[model samples]
Each structure stands twice: as C-alpha cells, then as structure tokens.
Target: GLLPAMALLARTLALLAMTLAITAIKVVPLDMARDSFDDQYRGCSPAMMAVLPALHNFEFQVNPLFTQTWVKAEAEWRKRGSPVSPLASPAQAVALMAYTTKDIYKDFNAAVRVAGHSRQEYRNNFHFKTLHFLLTKQCHHVFRGVHDVRFQARRGQKVRFGQFTSTSLSKEVAQKYGTDTIFEVQTCHGVDIQAFSFYLSNQEVLIPPYETFKAVLETNDIGVALFLNLVLFFVHSLDHLGFPKLLPLSPHWKVSSVSPGLNVIVHSSGSFTIL
Candidate 1:
C-alpha cells in the first residue's frame, strides 16, 4: 500500500512538472513580449499611435471583468469628488478607425492576381486594367491624401505570384513614375510595394457594422445556453425521481413503493433523512 501510494504521488509530480514545462514554453519573456507589442504599435497607423494611451484605456473598458474593476475604482475615486470617465477621447476615435481598418490592408502585396489566360495576355487584356483600377480606387479611398507610405521588401520575399526578385533599378523606376502608386515596378515580373499601405487603411473605415461584435456575443450566448440546459437537465432529473413529493412525507413513513426495504424520513426543514 505504501509503495502504491508513493508511485501515485510520483506520477502526480511528473504530470505537474510536465504542465509547468508546457506553460513555460508557451509564455513569452516579459521584456520580449513588451518589445513585440511596442513594435506592433509603432508599425500601426500614425493616427492610431497618436492615441495609444487612450486605446490602452479603452481596451480595459471593453473587458467585462476589467470594466467592473474600473467601475469600483471610479466609485472609490469619486468619493473624493474626482470622477474619471470610461469613454474614449476624441483622438481615440481616429485610433479606433486605424486599429479596426488595419485588417483590410494586411498582406496587400501578397494578393495574387489570377488570370484566365497567359501572364502576358492578362497584362495586355482589360482584366489587368480593371484590377489596377480597383486597386487604385481602394488606395485613394483608404489613404486619402496621405502619401508617406513606406515598406521594406526583401530581395527574395515569397509571395503568391512567386519569389520577389529584387532589382537595382527599383529607385530609378520609382523616380521615373511616382511613389504615389501602390507598387513600384522593380523588374519585368517582380514589383516593390509600400509596406505601410499593406497594413493601414482609411481613418473613415469603422468595424463591419456590428457583425464582428455579434459573433463574439454569440459565442458567449452558446456557453450560457449550454450551462442553462445542464441546470435544467439536473432539475428535471430530480423532479422525475419524485424528489419534491418525497420531501413532504413524514419521517416515520417507509418508502417501500420506490425501493423495497427503504426508509425515508422528512426532517422539519424539508430535508430527507434516508436510512
């Protein structure tokens, strides 16, 4: 018995060690995590970066548990007549737009323009024109007049079209035409594109009209529905077993009908004393 107990304890310790190891592997070092966040925030749109402090505060408000903490904190703060507002500032509105619209502009260059015919034919045909026109329209709409879009494309960047082969003539080409365009024609096949435009859209862009929020709320609804169903099932099971009716019965009575040789006694507080 002692040996078995020792083995069980060893197995539990091994499991705990394994769990801790896995957790440690998943957890990023604090400095590295902060640095990564800082990089992302820096890479974000200028409008978004302007109200970084407000965005940080707004993030806390969106969280239900965090909002509760904020409310309690505010209540305590207000006791000294120093009330704090939970609303995002006017500058944060622009930040919110930038934050939400970034997804639309993500991976702009990686977008593959599939053609029905050969590459040359596709370029010559109206299909290329139509595609370019659409892209130009989107660029104009999203960026407005902002033209300082800069991106660093590597020499051998892998994309859907194929590997991006860099050329020395990229600067000359950018100068010949204009950097106002979304992509600069670096070579016959490969193009150099702005990286900032790839991940930043217009300030006018708001989240897709509550569809995303609806999906998130629906997830919570599913969990609540399942929990309620489980509670109802348990309640139904107890009711089906005639637990409520049995509670009112006298303590001296024997419940021979439900189970043979079984004695059920009801206490003064509607509790069962089964023997």
Candidate 2:
C-alpha cells in the first residue's frame, strides 16, 4: 500500500526549507505617529491599544543612549520665507496694504492687480490663508479695535491643494504667525503651513482626488515585499491537507464553493517529519 504517512513527510520538509530561506524578517511595533512638532513629551507617547483591567506601569526600560549633533548655523528651511517671484505671500501683502486704503475692497482689487503680475495664484491665495483667519474668528482681541476692515477671497475656484501644498513650513513659525488649532487641523504632517493658509483665505483650492498618491510606493518597498511573501506561501503549498489562502484572509470558508480544511500534525525536517 502507498504510505499515506510518507507523503505527509515530504510536504513538511519542503515547507520548512522555504521558511528558513526567507531573506528578511521583521516584527510590528506600536507607534503614536505624532502629527506635529508642537506635540509635547508629556502626552504623545505610543502605547498598545488593548485595554487592561487595572493600572500598570513598567519600571525598567532599555535606552540605546543615542544623541544627535547639529551646527550653530540655521537648520535647513522647509519653505522659503523671503520674497520669491509670484509666490512671495501675495495674500499677506494684499491683506496688510488693503488696511491702509479708504475703500478696502477697491484697494485690494488694485493690490491684486499689482501683486498678481508676480504670481496670480499667490495673489489669489494670499498668504496661504493663515493670517486671513487671524482676522476672522476673533483670533486676537487686538483686531476688535483696529479698524472697520472688510476683505474677501473667492472660495469657489478649484486648485491642486485643498489645503495640502508642495511647500513645507516650519511648525515653529506657523505657531508664531498663525493659530495652532487652525494650522494643526488644516495642515498635513511635517512643516509647511502655506497650503493651510491658502485654504483658509479661500484664494486657492485643493486638487480633487489629491489623496490617491499621497504616499504611493513602488514594488521595491518592504511593505510590498511582505505582501508578496504571503502570496508565495499560499501558492506553493502542494500538500493535500494544507489550509487554503482564502480561508485565512476570511473565515467564511464553509459557505464558499472551494475551501480546504486544516492539518495540525504535519511538520518536516530532513528526511523524517519533525512534528
């Protein structure tokens, strides 16, 4: 009689060899994924999601004791501040200059005409909208007594950045010049408040369907590799009793047209079944 036990022995050997030959291995870790620089150490730390019954704390923790070094010189800027053609904060200049004119609306129209020559989009967007909201929402008590100021930026027109920007801004500067709550909610991760400012001003609009490519990756990345590995593991299972791949991704295998059941006893070593 053909030995049913012997065939099981062969399949286990093949599986073990493949698992051992894999090129990379990694373990998933919990991380907080903080969104801004203003976040403080007292709050934004990572912890496991599972809730336990009682209060708990761990005393001993390992620290590698690594430190970073930097020169006294200015750090690299994320977004340039000085006047640049077209994009040199057309909105801010317009907003400020608009204040000096008797007819605010007429003054802004003229300012846009002057500034729009550089970059109509910036003139159109006006300081990315940060300082615009500073005027609205009663950002500071100082605005109350300043002047009877009235301004407008069209919110209708569409643009690539709903609030997102190709530009990056420092969290330090954003906090100083703009409201922390406004920028924190509107801005994306890393420095760059230009998009948020533009959005609030209603001058520029975010590109439709902008999120589809936000963090797109090529086939070479580690996340892709891990997914491919799982695919290989399932496709190569020649064993008659091995569980099907679909069953793992979904547990509703019993209702499906084709679903392989489990085998808990098969393990392979050299020539004999190891488990």
State residue 98's C-alpha deviation in candidate 1, in Å: 24
**lDDT scores for all predictions?**
0.25, 0.21
Per-candidate TM equals 0.16, 0.15
| Steric collisions counted per model | 1, 16
The digit string of per-residue lDDT tens for model 1 on 39-80 reads 111122342333334333543544343334334434434453
Query: Which digits, one per residue and each the tens of the lDDT, describe model 2 over residues 99-142?
Result: 22222323223332232222233223232112111111101101
Q: What is the alpha-carbon lDDT of model 1 when measured against the actual structure?
A: 0.25
Report the error of model 1 at residue 16, Å: 4.2
C-alpha positional error of residue 70 in candidate 2 after TM-score superposition, expressed in Å: 3.0
* Candidate 2 residue runs with Cα over 4 Å from true position: 1-17, 21-24, 29-68, 71-187, 191-275
lDDT of 1 at 231: 6
